[model samples]
Target: MKLANLSIAAILAASSFAIAQDAAPVDTDGDGMMSPEEVMAAFPDVNEDVFTAADTDGDGMLSMEEFAAAQEDGLIPAEEM
Candidate 1:
């Protein structure tokens, strides 16, 4: 049972890491920063506030961690918005 639990935990950790890697920070403008306008342009239907909310770090670019954290925070849902 102990081994099985460890294996499960390892698998979960690896999966999480893969997802985190795959959900890379988008460079929408090719200018090295993920600006609010870029995000808005990508999902025009989504409110401008969504991009602002996602950029939690206030670095002017929504890093992968920041975006994922935003989703976890309910600021931006899993959907396009």
Candidate 2:
């Protein structure tokens, strides 16, 4: 019983870490779009030039579609497992 509990705890801890590493829903403002500021907050390594390229339409913000495209184009890193 003790071993089973320990195993469960370990799984839970690992899952929590994975969740923390995942990049998703960076649209923290509920605006359905991502601003350079929001992206930077979520991914500190992403600089302005990278973000401008990701913006695609030069709209100053990334719509969900643009964000997806950026991911597909390899401009954005895949979510860390």
Candidate 3:
């Protein structure tokens, strides 16, 4: 019984670690956190207003969809840093 419990605990711990690793990396833009600026910078030309728009979730922060939309809009460039 003890062995089974230990095995279960180990599996859970390993699963958590894997989940963390799969998560997105920290903000590289140095804006203190990952924001539209970082993603937009990676791609450029992303509409700044979309990121600033309050209607999208009303959180005042850009969601992954919004960021992706900006990319599709050509606001986020693929070159020029």
Candidate 4:
């Protein structure tokens, strides 16, 4: 039972990691960042204002880190992305 539990835990951990990786918004242009256009394409319902605000760097683009932060701050919904 202990071994089975450990195995299940490992599987869950791996799955979670994979999901997190897959959850990153596609960069589309391979620029290491996501433009508002790219984000809109992936999440049409996202508010432009919210997205602009989440762009903490004012770069007019969002890195994966920024995207995650937005999700955490409720500016973006995880399931919707």
> Per-candidate TM vs. native?
0.50, 0.64, 0.35, 0.65
Q: Give candidate 3's whole-model lDDT.
A: 0.50
Off by over 4 Å in 4: 1-20, 23-25
| Model 2 stretches astray by more than 4 angstroms | 1-24
In candidate 4, what residue range of length 10 has the lowest lDDT sum? Answer: 16-25
> Can you write out model 3's per-residue Cα lDDT over 7-46, one digit (the tens) per residue?
9999988865543332233236433333765545554544
Clash pairs for candidate 2: none
| Best-to-worst ranking by TM-score | 4, 2, 1, 3
Q: What lDDT does each candidate get?
A: 0.63, 0.74, 0.50, 0.77
Sorted by lDDT, highest first, which candidate order results? Answer: 4, 2, 1, 3
Please give, for residues 9-79, the per-residue lDDT of candidate 2 as tens digits.
99988865543334345777867678998887777777899899999899999877677667678877665
Measured by lDDT, the strongest candidate is 4
**Between candidates 1 and 4, which one is better according to lDDT?**
4
Q: Write the per-residue lDDT of candidate 1 for residues 1-81, one digit (tens) a residue.
A: 999999999998886676455443344545445566655655565466777778877777776667667667876555453
